[model samples]
Target: MAQLRQWATTLGFSQIGVADVDLSSAEPGLMAWLARGFHGEMRYMASHGLKRARPAELVPGTVRVITARMDYLPASVAAEGWQAVEWARLQRPDAAAVSMYARGRDYHKVLRARLQKLADQLAALIGPLGYRVFTDSAPVLEVELASRSGVGWRGKHTLLLSREAGSTFFLGEIYVDVPLPLTEPVTAHCGACRSCMDMCPTQAIVGERQVDARRCISYLTIEHDGPIPAELRPLMGNRIYGCDDCQLACPWNKFAQRARVPDFDVRPALNDPTLLQLWRWDEATFLRLTEGSPIRRIGHARWQRNIAVAMGNALAAWRDRVLTADEASLRAQMVQALQAWLAAPTVTGEAQAQVAEHVHWALAQQHAPQ
Candidate 1:
């Protein structure tokens, strides 16, 4: 076990633990969450069914699961005042606030390659081991396995949290047929804190350790591939990619670790971009700029759609208060860009409909009473 830990550390995993394959205890909560339809448009979650809870079934003969955590705070964010920096970005009504995790190379590719290497290392040591590696894969209950393997306790926000690393990390797993000793689980530390729930821009955290994805800004902007609910667009603020309000509000994040692997470093293209700047990217430019980044997975249309909603929110904020000379200049520039795009004939069909509708909503906010 100690040697395996050493190998994982060398592979850039912050921590690794072995968990017994028995996840029957978690099936009830999984079923209940699905029954309540909290997963929203993430049909993949429901499509997997109970197979998510049955690790051994998913990988026949697997008696143990290896859980790994990789810290993802970019090197650019100062460790001492990172939360303040993120909060300030959120306060900027025109900034396109991306979740810290997706600001760099796609973690799915990074973690999977490293995990497969780790599995190969194990097989070399033990001689002919059956194993499968998974990173953010839909058929696995990653959080449940991670928590049970002592990676961290589950926070009220349903994210795995650690005293040493907090919730700003990515999770991956390896199911092995070998019977490794199980690591003990950690105890919960969220005694009486509800800051995450209170600070969620759309109140997506419906209950303790429960999140309703339908109202989650992350889900609405990223996963739901149709029109964003008209009522929820304003609450989304300027978060153009994924939302991090819950993690930002958690006190444990003071301990969040920076990435050991440079692949998780924040890209210059994503760091503190303005809504107007990102909104101007055409489909080809969007694809070119976000080439290796996870943001590319959402594609150009969803990218524009998210920016349009954010621009609308920024427009509303500008209209709601008195502005300085600089603020007024920015507001005017944003309005002009939005209007020019509205008049352009290049965009059409569903993509055009979503962007145009959001643009009109933003324009309407200019004339509405504060």
Candidate 2:
């Protein structure tokens, strides 16, 4: 087991633990969460049923589960100003915000391949073994398994949290028939801290250890299809990808570890792009840049929809600048898009009202005395 841990750590996993097959204790909570309809459009969460909690039932012959966590904070992140940098991105209404995790190579591919390599190495040493590796796959309750295996405790934000590593890590698991020694569970230290709940912009974290997926920015921006809700669009601010306000507000994140791999580094295109700059990217540019990225999965239509919301927020923020622009071309372009959206029959009444209000505000700014 020590050898296995050493090998796993060398492959970028920060920690590993073994858990028994029984997860009956978590079934009720899972059923209740599903019953409440908090899973949103993720129907698979309900379809899997109790099979998610029972590792042996999901994968026959599985007697033990080995869980691993890999810290994902990029190495280039400034030591002292990281949190401030993240906060500033939200304030800049013109900048396009891609979630920190998706700025690099897709994690699904990265973690799964590394896990399979670890399994193969173990097989070579201990004889042929029956095992399967999973990373963020729908069939298992990842956070529950991680917590039970002593990888971390479930934080108030409902994400697996570790005192040493915080919640800024990706989890992976290997289900096996071998009886590996179980690791001791760690005591949770969240205590009276409710920063994650208080800082959620959309009030998604309704209670301690509970999140309403319908109101979560991450869920709205990523998992949701079709038009974004009008009331929530402005609240989304400049975030075009996923929201990290809950995790960022957690005090324990001061100890979050940085990734050792270069694959997690921020791409140049995602770092400091303006809202209009991203809005101008047609489908071709979008496909070309997001080639191997997880962002590509959202497709061009949703990508444009997110950017349009950000652009609307930017127009609201810089209304005065738009009015004073001597360049007729720039003014015409902005007005043209606003008018086009207003004319579109599919646009909701609420969206038309917002566009009209913004146009009126801009026109008023233009006629004001110098």
Candidate 3:
């Protein structure tokens, strides 16, 4: 385990743990969450069924799972109280506030490659090892495994939280045939704290440790690939990529660690960009700018749809307030951008469906009350 820890540190992993394969206890909660439709449009969550909880079923020879944590808070973020900078960005109606996680290279690729290498290392140490690596790509119960393996306890926001690392990290797993010593599980620390729920603009944290994805700004902007719900649009504010209100509001994040690897560093394009700046990127530019970034997966249409919602929110934010000369100029720019898109019925030729209604809603917001 000590050798594995040293190897993990060299591979840019923050922490490591080993969990037993008997996750039968978590199956009930998984079914309950799915029954309540909490998974939203993430159909794959239901498709895999009990295979998610049964590591032995997912990989026949698996006896124990190796859980890994990789901190993603970019180094460029202010070392002290970076959450304040994000909150300030949220207040700026025109800034395109992307989730800190997606600001850099896609985590899926980074974690998967390293996990495979780690698995290979283990095989070298113990001949003919059977194992499979997975991150968010599979239906494996990541948070459950991590928590069980002492990676961290699951917070009220449904994210793994650690006294040492906070919630600003990504999780990966390697199911192995080797029966390694189990790591000690950590106790939950979220006693009498509802800051994440209160901070949720759309009230998506419906219950203790349960989130309704339909109402979540992060889910709406990223996972759901349709028109923005009218009521939730304004609440989304300027978060055009993914939302971070829940994580930002958590007190433990003050201890959020910076990424040790350059792969998680923030891209220059995403460093405090305005909605207008991102809105100006057409399909080609969008693809170019987000080449290796996770934002590219949303495609140009969904990207347009999300920004349009933020732009409408920006317009509504100042609908009742007086504007300075510069503010008026910015307002005109926003109005003109919305109008230009409205002029063309097809927002994007490649869009599966046009976001015309969203633009209309955005223009209509010009007359809405504060």
TM values, all candidates: 0.98, 0.88, 0.97
Give the winner by lDDT: 1 or 2: 1
Q: Judging by TM-score, tell me the better candidate of 2 and 3.
A: 3
| Best model per lDDT | 3
For lDDT, candidate 1 versus 3, the one ahead is: 3
The residue-by-residue lDDT of candidate 3 on 1-370, one tens digit each, is 9989999999999999999988899999888988999888988888988899998988899999999999999888899979999999999888899999999999999999999999899888878888899989877989999999999999988999999988999999999998889999999998999999899999999988888888998899899987777888888999998899999999999999999899989899998999999988878899999999999999888999998889998998878899888778888999999888777643445463447778778888989555
RMSD, every candidate, angstroms: 1.2, 4.8, 1.4
Q: What is the Å distance of residue 233 in model 2 from its true position?
A: 1.5
How high is the CA lDDT of each candidate model? 0.89, 0.80, 0.90
Comparing 2 with 3 on lDDT, the higher-scoring candidate is 3
TM-score for predicted model 2 compared with the true structure: 0.88
Model 1, CA-based lDDT: 0.89
Model 2: per-residue Cα lDDT over 1-370, one tens digit each: 8999999989999999988888899989888888888888878888888899999988899999999999888888886668789999888755788888888888889999999999999899899889999999858889888998899999999999998988888999999988988987888999999999999988988888888888888898889875677778768877889988888898888889999677788888877787666656766898898887889998766776776677666655565554445444444565566456446522344544543444344333324335
Clashes of each: 0, 1, 0
Clashing pairs in 3: none
In candidate 3, how many clashes are counted?
A: 0
- Order of candidates by TM-score, top first? 1, 3, 2
- Please give, for residues 236-343, the per-residue lDDT of candidate 1 as tens digits: 989988899899999999999999999988888887788888888888889998988988988888888888888888888888689999889988998898889888
